[model samples]
Target: MSDTSPFDPVGHESLADAVVEQIETMIVDGILKEGHKLPSERDLAEAMGVSRPKLREALQILESRDLVTVRHGEGSFIAPLSGRAMSPALLALYARHGRAFYDYLEYRREQECFAARTAALRATQSDKDRLRDIIDEMQKAWEEDDAEASQEADLRLHVAVVDASQNTTLIHMMASVYDLTRQGVFYNRRFLRTMDGTGEKLLQQHKDIVATILAGDPDAAEQAARAHLDFVEESFRLGEEQKARETRAAKRRKLSGQASR
Candidate 1:
């Protein structure tokens, strides 16, 4: 009988969420407070009924929102009111459905807007040439109707702008979490479809952005970036809203059928 199992069994599909909730509740209930240092990673992993990876994901979410902070060579600590930071969980939740799409897009727009502004001031001529090449690649890919490749090219162009800043910190910030932003751009996969000649419009926008960067005109570069982002943001927001409405209507009809039965 090998010492008779000392514990009972528990079952839940999303154990990670449950663990996160428990820790969150403890913090809310005053068991844990802001600025309080948490146990070492090893200790917390042992204390929680979760794997290190799961715990790390939870901690990453909190860190993104500034709920926690991990200093170099030090353990994690609860963060003070550090304002809002971009959390992975938030991005995933937003990307899950249409309603949350705009939120994530707006967040991305703000980040990119700043990146463009900085790059305008800091980008070198070589950086300008690099960005133009990426845009040209996007045009070629789109012409070939290679939707996936086109999208990648588009992202590369934007990421190139951020990279042109030659600022690793900024590049790292964008690279760290860009999946949801990228997905939201093609939200509902609509980007794969023909743009009905919107391609030229988009191309001009890119040209304007690059021209400003080359001319060292920070104001124009920032505005061009914002304008381009605004168009994409609006398209995503409208499409997402429409999808959510359709989903809700479908749910209602399903419920009505069950009730009739």
Candidate 2:
């Protein structure tokens, strides 16, 4: 009887499977972020050390899995995974309700605290450098009194911390959350920026978070994240209250004038 094993040695199919895994891992790690276009098939195959046929097979599989979108002539691109994670209906609901703002903050507080703690443990040297650069950007924005730039940097800092956590799930989920924040679906980012002394305080809070993470102090990083969120919640409350009072005062003045007329 022949002594050959029943299983075949790993072959073209296996090579294709490996290519799929490599691309998937890159996507999950955010190395190939959403909507990033893939290189030409020949270039990619050469870079990946695989034959063009195997790369094509892997690309086909990824396209079917909704992880990639292929254009007939333009080449393949990473699908917008983060955007798909949150439904339009849910986004609209959050936008329609004031209560959702605080709820979002509460959710973010927990998420950010966990992210900061994990980042402290997992952050690479490159991650630390990115955080430092973002802090510097925030400082520049603050000095220039540029609320929009400051707000953008604020979100970028939080996103960078989450990225440093090296947790794929958290990174994707928070991407959607931050997208909502950018769209002002929960609360106006400007409100937090416009409060008295808030820009300075926020810049410092971000710096402290980065410092703790860089120091590899998980406890301090978590606490700093929580404290920062607490301040943001309080600032939002105060801003809302002040707006309500102003609206009421305006209504009263309008009524008084009409009655006098």
Off by over 4 Å in 1: 1-92, 182-189, 192-198, 244-261
Provide TM-scores for the models: 0.54, 0.86
Report clashes for each candidate as comma-separated counts: 0, 0
Which 10-residue window in model 2 sums to the lowest lDDT? Answer: 1-10
Clashing pairs in 2: none
lDDT of 2 by residue, 1-261 (tens): 123322122245588888888788888887677778988887777666677888898889999999999999999999989775458897887677788778889999999999999999999998999999999999999899888898888889999999999999999888878888877777766767677455777788899999999999999999999999999899988988999999999999999999999
Candidate 2 wrongly placed segments (more than 4 Å) = 1-14, 82-86
The models' CA-based lDDT, in order, is 0.67, 0.86
Question: How high is the lDDT of residue 90 in model 2?
Answer: 78
Candidate 2 versus the native: TM-score?
A: 0.86
Tell me the TM-score of model 1.
0.54
State the lDDT of candidate 1 residue by residue for 140-172, as single tens digits.
876776767766777777777877666665665
